[model samples]
Target: MRTFQHKVTINDMGAITIFGLGAFFCLWNRTNSLMVILGCLLIIVTIRAVDRAIHTSYVLTDDSALQIKTGRIGLTKHILLSEVKSVEKRPFAFHLGHYALIEMMNGSVVSVQPDNVDSFLSALKKRIEKKDNEV
Candidate 1:
């Protein structure tokens, strides 16, 4: 099994912190309860997103077949390597962050965002090559 793990980048942290602080300050100064509630929700969302970003990891295992697993939200997705048709790194758009599109031969696509995009791509490519060689 080969594993690739990465934490949220400093840049991501800084952005999240700025957003959280802004919401907190707005909540503190606002007199409306609805505004305050919205601010609180925003803060919660930001924190959760940051935590997930930092904690997410991916693992690839080679047996008779290949298995890919991604960890997040106390759950892991197991995918067979033979099912994967291709992997493509797409450009960051909006809040999506850097994404890897795992295209399956059956025409299913799974989108994943890893903290260190370059390393994730490299590791995925290596695993794909290894799986292909085994076949």
Candidate 2:
């Protein structure tokens, strides 16, 4: 089994922080409380996103299942290799860019960006192929 921990890029955190603060300032002291609420929501969203990213981790099992876990919200997902339709590796763009997109047989998609994406993909392919041989 191989495990990878996702780290939130500094650039991403900085960008989100700046944007959230800007929104809060713009909406502050507004006549209606609705605007303030909206600003707070924005900031909350930013915090959640960053928190999730920081806590996200992946586990690749020998049986060809990839487990995604986010400690922040206690979210866990398992994607079986047999059910995966396709896997795409994307070159990193900005700080918050995702590395891989896994499409499942049920038409749903899961996105993950492990710290070492190339190695993750290589290991995943090997595990999937090994499972197929066993089957």
Maximum-lDDT candidate = 2
Clashing pairs in 2: none
lDDT assessment of candidate 2: 0.78
Give the per-residue lDDT of model 2 (tens digit) for 20-76.
786677577666888777777777777777777678899998767899997676678
Question: Which candidate number would show the highest TM-score if scored against the true structure?
Answer: 2
| Lowest summed lDDT window (length 10), candidate 1 | 64-73
TM-score of every model versus the real structure: 0.65, 0.75
Clashes of each: 0, 0
How do the residues 41-116 of candidate 1 rate in per-residue lDDT, one tens digit apiece?
Answer: 8887777667666676666665523333333554666777767788888866565567788888989888776667
Q: Which pairs of residues collide in model 1? A: none
TM-score of 1: 0.65
| CA displacement after TM-score superposition, residue 118 of candidate 1 (Å) | 5.5
Q: Which stretches of candidate 2 lie over 4 Å from their true place?
A: 7-11, 26-30, 92-98
